[model samples]
Target: MGSKLGAAVAAVVLALPLLVGAGVAGIGSALFGGSGTSSLNCTPDGTTTGTVPGMTAEQMINAATIVAVGKQMGVPEPGWVVAIAAALQESKLRNLHYGDRDSLGLFQQRPSMGWGSPQQITTPTYAATKFFEHLTATPNWQTMSVNDAAQTVQGSGFPHAYAQHEDKARAVVAAVSGVRCQPTMAGTGDCNNIQAPNPAAMTAINYACGQRGLPYVWGGNGPLNGDAGFDCSGLTKAAYDAAGISLPRTAHTQYNAGPRVPDGSLLPGDLVFYGPPSKIRHVGLYLGNGKMLNAPTFGQPVQIDNYRYPGDDYAGATRPAEHHR
Candidate 1:
């Protein structure tokens, strides 16, 4: 991942559009009543009900807070699932004022560990916001399994515990936000409807998607190269190679070897890059709707993730298929 090359042209700041949409309304109508306005309020208003089944009114309200904060931050539905799942495992979606050591609130975030003060950490909105912030900061988090993404942010001793709550968490998110996300380890559920720009792009995307769940083997070129999996540039190279387009072996070289895609105009199958131009380190195959298919770092497999995230060092994108044409 650290194959550095010299600088190319000035960096282009990408214009990523916010991915938001109207979710199905009244999924929680039994609890929230016909007026959807009631569910939007994160604060408990005494009229709350266990419309989600198995969860109490208070737990549902906290879940609602988590969903609301994620939407306000423009976090995609998968992120909300991760946040809510972490909350479920940590505090059963209740905003508790006590936990192991200084761990507190719905996420059991430690006040002593810089999560925030007890008062702030106990606040439902504040806790949910903090959880989402950390989750989004994790590189390629959208590609990670719900438990893996939750553990990456929470750093819990019981790392595997978060997985148990994912179904419930996803259910809570759907109930509160009315958006049913069919999240899979292979890709974010939101990207299924996104169409590739052309047959060639579609071919490349399909090729990459087929490689999902493969390990991230640095310098590996996938099964065709006789390795188990792929590296960032290796996966992109292999995907385009399947589409009959040749690309440079490393990320920096590939960035410089582009029919450079203009900023704000990325299309599916475009090769998105990260890090400075002088030392580009990461690359992924754009899968449209702000999602990408890539072999993210060691321990992570080939999977789909948002192309942009908080603290991401996105460089730019290149349309390799354009060069082929």
Candidate 2:
């Protein structure tokens, strides 16, 4: 049953891009502190970049385990990149046999901080989750900054250093994630599952997409709920309501409600989240192939893209009530 569920999810992923054009996406691809590829064009940063050096491939493989863990834990690619970059800055992704003094494993987690046994920290996924789980609890973490989000968790000596690796992290995410993520066509039901939308969510996603060129309003959801402009999550949420689905008013709440999607099986209409892993603060509806129809901010209108927030803090996906219908 579990394998069928997994395959069903996989089928939905494979058909999604075709369905959306269709598009959707995410995947974790590194562990705490690993060096990034640093050779691709991507969105610039408003955050810290982490990169040190001396990461062995063995350590790199460990970081890869985090990618799988992040996807499973609902951490987005952006979060994955940030976590990886921070780890790179901290331990060079080596999953160090030891830390600054007694700090052991990747990111030099301290035994004093309750990081776990040395072997656990050495396990790539264990280390990454420890980092992410800690990040999720930082105070004011949501609004602080990306590297800052990491800093709150890892508590490294360097907060500014993480930014240097942002581009590299972005590159890694692009290089590794795309190859793995394959959104399915929602409602197909075989391993080819393409679950139908409940009506309101589909309407919500389409309505915003339909108003492709409208101005983005701070709190507007059209003059009558589906016409004019919309705030970030508001635009997508209203459309979902139109489709007959009920969703919590905020992105964080959305994360709390659904079955966490694994990274490799993304699909259209999947709720993509952004912001701190510890605190989900934003969301968008996935379209497919590689695009998302969203009500971007103040100056932007609902536009299509391969991911959310130029791909920042993507905390993974969830199915809204309508999506399961």
Candidate 3:
């Protein structure tokens, strides 16, 4: 995603030694490509735009748009960092009418290459979403270095360019999203300061959290049925079951059996359901700060991810603790 405009600067910078190693390859892929298995130590601490230095108002707005799009798409803060860094390297965070060859917009995607029509590629929201779609498709992209991740998506001639912007990208993401993310040794970042779960709901939350990294199996229940993995509803059902509450076997049935919580009032331990009301396809245990613990899909593990994403069919949430109370 590095723009030709930034390539010259990147070449000069790449002459200096870089401290970051190559991102690990061959890890199993997830919906967004990172291992959400580990807990993040970051929190939505509050936005601080002044902390990001030397950007014009337009640039800042574009940067915020990128972050906002990432959030809307249920991308994690790390993904936001990659998107911002890619944007910074590509067009310096400016939505432009032109780039190298047919390239256009923030990431310099090209209409001729099927990134989109010229109009769609130039639009900030459309551009960011397209970038994330490619990014999340890259295997182990979440663990890739900024340069590597961006290059994987952009196929840039200047492959090393994006790394130079990583620090600034992290800063931009924090400034815009109010979430401070610290990269972990495992090549993932942890978020902290999530609101505490209701005391009565802790057992369920703890049970679900403890099952991170288990495989996702269709109609499978963890251990209770001698299966090593869990499907979405199976995880939630087992989690609540550990808390002395019984839940129905399937996602739709589970939603029907609810003491439903309203939107914007989701507490930790709420069972967040997705898909239409008549055909809820997935469920996750809410873990606050927009994260949820669930068995996402085949090949993905039980892990934490943003509960909401662009075009995700989010049904609603239910409080099993309240139901039993």
**Top candidate (TM-score):** 3
Error of 2 at 63 (Å): 3.4
Q: Rank the candidates by TM-score, best first.
A: 3, 1, 2
The weakest ten consecutive residues by lDDT in model 1 span 5-14
**Greater-lDDT candidate between 1 and 2:** 1
208: Cα error in model 1, Å? 0.1
34-85: candidate 2 lDDT, tens digit per residue = 1211111112233211111443434344444445445544566667777777
What lDDT would each prediction earn against the true structure?
A: 0.70, 0.55, 0.70
lDDT of 2 at 167: 69
* Model 3 ranges off by over 4 Å: 1-47, 179-261, 264-325
Please, what are the lDDT tens digits per residue for candidate 3 over residues 116-147?
A: 77876776766887888788889998888888
Q: Which of the two candidates, 2 or 3, achieves a greater lDDT against the reference?
A: 3
Q: Each model's number of backbone clashes?
A: 0, 53, 10
- What are the runs in model 2 whose C-alpha is more than 4 Å off? 1-56, 139-142, 179-325
